[model samples]
Target chain A: MESLYLAWRYLVYHRFKTLLLVLSLTLLFFVPVGLRVLVQQTALELQRRAATTPLLVGAKGSSLDLVLSGLYFEGTRPEPLKGAEIERVQDSGLALAIPLHLGFEAQHHPIVGSTVEYLDFRALEIEVGRRFVFLGECVLGAAAAKELGLAPGSTLVSSPQNLFDLAGVYPLEMQVVGVLAPKGTPDDRAIFVDLKTAWVIEGLGHGHQDLSKDDAAAGVLKRKGSQITANASVREFQRITDENRDSFHFHGDRSAFPVTAILALPHDAKSKALLMGRFQSKDETSQIVVPSKILDQLMGTVFTVQDYIVAAVVLVGLSTLATAFLVFLLSWRLRRGEIETMVRIGASKGRIRALLLWELAFVLSLSVLLAAVLLLLTASQGGALLRHLLLT
Target chain B: MIRIQDLSYRYPEGGFRLLLPELDVARGEAVALIGPSGSGKTTLLRLISGILLPEAGRIHVGDQDVSSLSESERRAFRVAGIGLVFQEFELVEYLSILDNVLLPFRLHGRLRLRDADRERAAGTLQDLSLGDKMDRRPAHLSQGERQRVAIARALVTEAPLILADEPTGNLDPQTKGQVVELLRTKAGEAGATLLMVTHDHALLDLFGRVLEFGEEEGATTLVDREGAQ
Candidate 1:
């Protein structure tokens, strides 16, 4: 006890040196452990989400980008598939195709356009109010709701695709009908709207005042045999409401409307193989991909990278340990007089050694404890950190 | 009290050897040993304190055969029975004056540090006129004060034998005289045998007996100064 007390006093007297040593050792211990934990967590998270989402169908481009955009709502937007692809997959009786339109954003959160079944398929539960049942109505993810400070009955305006494009789609003020419970997934950060509302935001559909109305008479350019052409002065609705919703219309063929991807949920193994086989043809314009397979490959690469990182960290740790050992050796040399004083005062060899060992033990124990605390904090916050890394 | 018979010690590197046929100091005697440099005065103090063992001798301090004791036993005995003071005042700089004084009790497990030990340490510092500086480290003290702290450490153990090797070597003239006087007075009051080695001849009168080491036929010889007071 006395030796320990003396050791403690010595360390306290030289607190700055002791603290530097402790910090070095802490980083040495924490880096490798914390990195492994985060990598494992990221791997598990990617695999779990991808496993739950069985298959993805998108334009015949990068399968990785399609999976990233469809599952995580991140990465470069894949070339969009036609709306008719959903019906084509459904008619084959091989899978249920869920359309996704993901090019729009409101308040920096992605606007995910899908059918109401997307929520049920992903097992999302509404925490406030009801799901969107009409065009221009949106349901907020928990994080999106908290970030945008919009609850049920609040309105959110979509961001314009290009602020400089004068003839581009105007911003749409969509009504917030509900907020979903947090799932610690990409869904928690997305704003969900019906597919028609997304098409309206894309400027493919719109609501406008009747050209025959007397109020709009001045905005009309010409009329001939009940075919009227209106000039740009005609008022177009920026928001869809009960009173003006009937005025909204799409001018193109509905089947050809754009969808970024389709989540294909097959009936069973045979259906999954058949659907994948259908898209295997060289001339097929759309490609079907198994999400888990792509993610597994990605994780394999991540694991290899993690191995290199751990190796580098271990090398650095070795250097730090060597430096610390040198510092301790120099410190002992400096303290030779003090040790001699103890010896001449009848301090036994064992007691002298115990004093030195106790000092080292205290430093090592503090470093271990600090590293453990950091690792636990990383474990608890790993999901949010992975999301930030993946999305950003 | 100390007794040495047929004592012989030689450095292993082979340049110096000490040979003493016989020596004795009665209990409670204050003896000043004066010698030239490398005359084995400090070496003799180390031998008496069990810090060094003679190659051929029987050394007795009080009733214990110090030279015959094992290394660990000698350590325990030294901490309990011998108090040592040095020229450099070799106090642990990191420890406060009071902790320095209590170092012997803290160093050896044989001596259990009790509240009484703390009070004795505090009282020793008070007797040295360092009561208010008990919490001050050695670096914050002057040369004289540091030497006094070393003396307080030596006295705090209440050892029957106090061996000081040039305890006032670093002090100014007046401080050196005062330090020697204080050490003699403290040793007298505690009834301890004081064997102090010093180069200062002026302080010789402070001791009850004085022994001078001189070369005789290439061996060291101790001559008594006027037999005794």
Candidate 2:
């Protein structure tokens, strides 16, 4: 007890060193724990979003890219699926498909133009105003609402598809019609619009009215019979509409308009499994991904390296602690006269040793506790920031 | 009683050697060891307390021959049977006077001197005229007061042998007389054998015997014994 008591006293005496040691060990502990929490929160967000949509089908490529671009709204511009492909799924009685036309951006945030079902699938309930019903109208995620400071009537001009695209691509101005409630996931950062709007922004489709020469000559064609047609033109041209949309023109058939991907939801597991198998074996340029399984694989690879790094850091921390202890032992030898004085007073060596060990244990235990508390605080706060950064 | 026979010690640094053919002290005897700084007074004290072993020789304290004991055994013997008052008053600076005095009892096993032990330490400090300062740490105590606390600690366990290094070397004349008198009185009442090493020649008459260190040459009477003052 005396020896331990002495150790304890010595550690207490050197309060600064104890603090430094605790800090070093805390950093050693913090990284792994913090990363783990981030990973957990991210995976949870991904899984929650994935569950809402039963299936994600994209142009044949990395399944991970499909999930990232389709579900998480991340990754590069994947080749678009023909509008006919989505029609194929919709024509089939087995599944319901929602077309997602991505591959565009406005101010570094991706512009996701899809059917109303995308919002329904995400379960993003409106907190204020109405949903997008007209061309150029937008529904903002909670994060987008806060970040862009856009509300019911706020107007946002579309920036280039690529965030770093300084050359300025389609910079079309769009109106924000609604803001969705926070989903604690990536749904907060997305800009939702009608699929046609995405196509128009990509210069792949345009809004049109059939022109009559005689009616144009009569100067009343605007009020006469002019069939509204969906225009598909890959090339840029001029535009003319009630909205005075643009001068960019695309030359392509409306029926063959391109879509980035499709989200399918089957009624049961059998249908889902069958749909997934078909996509896997299909000759069409498409692949299906289960977000949950992909996440597990991702985490597996991540954790392997993370575990190794944490183990090495902890080993180094422990070794430094051991060296600190050795310094203590060596110092004890230098203080033999002082120790002898204690022994001569009837203090047993055991007591002295106990005091020494107690000192170190107290400091280490305190440091670990402080680091844990800090981790908790950071997880709670930093988690919010991460959701905003990675999710909608 | 304390006894040493054919004790010879060599410094690891190859300094002067210490050789004693015979040395003895009976119970309640007060002896003074006078020597210059490097004459091995502290080394002899350390040897007697079993802190250091004589290169070759024997050191017997009562019925136990310390030179024959193991390192751990010697530590136990030193804690239980000998009281050492260091010249520097090497008190564990963090502990209060009361805890310092009670330290030996805490160190040696089977000697549970908790509340009662503290009470005994209080009494010893009172006898050393330091009762009021029991709760104070050594840093707060003056030089004379610190020395008394060290002495009080040595006497707290009521051990049979008291070895002091330069007990009054730093005290004023009046305090030096008082300290030496206290040591003699405590040794007599406790039936303890006291060996004090000092350079102060004024205290020669206070002890029953004295042993001078070093060999004499033509100009220097290097080893001249002077009884207690």
Q: Best by lDDT, which number?
A: 1
Over A229-337, each residue of candidate 2 has an lDDT whose tens digit, in order, gives 2323222223323444443345677658878788887778887887777776656576777777776676577568668977887788678768766766776787687
**Share of true Cα-Cα contacts across chains kept by each model:** 0.90, 0.57
Candidate 1, residues A209-233: lDDT per residue as tens digits? 9898899998899999799999989
Superposed model 1: Cα runs more than 4 Å off: A147-150, A159-170, A207-244, A390-392, B126-133, B226-229
Lowest lDDT 10-residue stretch of candidate 1 chain A: A383-392
lDDT of 2 by residue, B1-229 (tens): 8888989888887757888888787787888888777888888888888888989999999999999998778877887788888777888786778877887765677566678778888998998888888878789988888888888878877789999998787788888878888888887798999999999878878987888876433111224354634
| CAPRI quality of model 2 | acceptable
Q: What is the C-alpha RMSD of each candidate to the true structure, in Å?
A: 2.8, 8.5
Q: What lDDT tens digits, residue by residue, belong to model 1 across residues B6-57?
A: 9998867776788899999999999999989888899899888888899998
Clash count per candidate = 0, 53
